[model samples]
Target: MNRNVILTCAVTGAGDTTGKNPNVPVTPRQIADSCIEAARAGASVAHIHVRDPETGGISHSTDHFREVMERVREADTDIVMNITAGGGGDWTPDSEDPTRGGPGTDIQTPAERHEPVGELLPELCTLDCGSLNFSDMVYINTAEWLREHARLVQQAGVKPELECFDLGHVWFARQLQQEGLIDGDPLYQLCLGIPWGAEADTETMLAMRNKLPDNADWAAFGIGRHQMPMVAQAMLLGGHARVGLEDNLMLKKGVMATNGQLVEKAGGIIENLGGRVMTPAETRERLKLRDPSTGKIVGGEA
Candidate 1:
């Protein structure tokens, strides 16, 4: 295997993992600290998502995002921060009226979904493409909504990581690219192993990866037990890999893992495969990322 890879640490997700594992960070400070530790453990990027401090459920509050960003910035770590713009899409049909949302729904407009990303303007933010039955609940991301969010992300001068959960989602992402909704070399993230979406197997991964645009920069991740295997699979297939407590909480069966541990484990896997992990600076250069302030690729790489 080639010895050059980028490892992203999904520090904390917006999932309901807090109750399942007490080690999952709930507060902004805790999330920021976990990201810093992961960065120190060979992660080039930290994919972040904040939760309600009180309820521990997913939240898209600008205040919470600001807190997390400020804390991470204050630490002066070189890790590239990638905040999620994927929240507020959950919906449960009304038990009485199937056409309407039920009490558990948290649907919002595209503008509402972009609020946090607009506020933070992180180096990278996710843009989930297409919609699917996310397990029992529906993840509603209509084409109209995605176009609006993509425009906002472009205007903010942030790189939008196109997140595709299935083959159709990848096709929709390509459509967005064709429409010029996204800017620069499109960055895609193939999300696998979620229920009712793509499975986390080599065949599924390859099929999705082969469909990406020729000039695209992309990464792939698998949830649960498929996480580590996908790490090596992605590396061998000429793409980056992501791992963390958010995707897989266990280091082994019945054993919980911290964000740092997950990153370190992925790093070891990459190294063992003869791939050298890329640092954040190297990743920024390879991806041709512009300094948000200067609006040009920094460090003279471009």
Candidate 2:
């Protein structure tokens, strides 16, 4: 089991979850407040995704990202910021014409998807290692696109949390490392329990964890009901943990959970498992992340 754990609270994801949970942060101010709340509640990092304030839809606006960053920075407590760079790959085929994109389609080039991370330069950003059958839609991230995206993230001096939704993604992430696209020891986020992706169970998590580079720092999370359980499972398997409304909505059956509540629960689980939750500073050193304030890598890993 891992003694020191890093807990990441993904404040709000790009999914259509705002309508389902009232506590899901939609506006920039609300998102920033959630991050601060998670930080105070013992989250080492806040994985952020900005939404359209007016419509409560996913947005790629740099202005919105900037606002969220500013508000979080103005808060008293500190937490490592991990912005999402895996947006705009949704491809729901049109019902009328199978060849055309449907209404839910949101596709962008590597540069467009990396715009926020490139501009804001957060301590960490996500890189979805491969595409998957994301619910009814196919989230498209080709190998070519991934290599280019990794290069851009490396150029910005930001650490890309390789988000592997399946075993093949783990393979491709290793390939990226071998090709010298990823700098330093790679950080990984094993995503489980999404529709048609890796299953949320001990066996699957272990299999993926076994494939990771020995020197890599990794965390794992399960969607919906598996969120809390995966926290314990990840720690037991010698990895870190992640929690937030982005992956799960309820703290318990029929109870909507805020980001702070999720972080608190995850922290409790980590402590109960005889593992200590790492602080933001310690997480930076552990993950070799760039300091958000100075933009220099910690431990001289640059």
Q: Best candidate per TM-score, number?
A: 2
lDDT of 2 by residue, 1-302 (tens): 99899999999999999999999999999999999999999999999999999999989999999999999988889999999999999999899998999999999999999999999989999999999999899999999999999999999988899999999999999999999999888899999999999999999999999999988999999999999999999999999999999999999998999999999999999998888999999999888778877767888854
- Candidate 1 vs. true structure, TM-score: 0.96
Candidate 1: minimum summed lDDT over ten consecutive residues — where? Answer: 293-302
- State how far residue 57 of model 1 sits from its true place (Å): 0.9
Identify the runs in model 1 with alpha carbons over 4 angstroms from their true place. Answer: 292-296, 299-302
TM-score computed on alpha carbons, candidate 2: 0.98
- Model 1 CA lDDT for position 153: 90
Give the alpha-carbon lDDT of every model: 0.88, 0.94
Alpha carbon lDDT of residue 217, candidate 1? 82
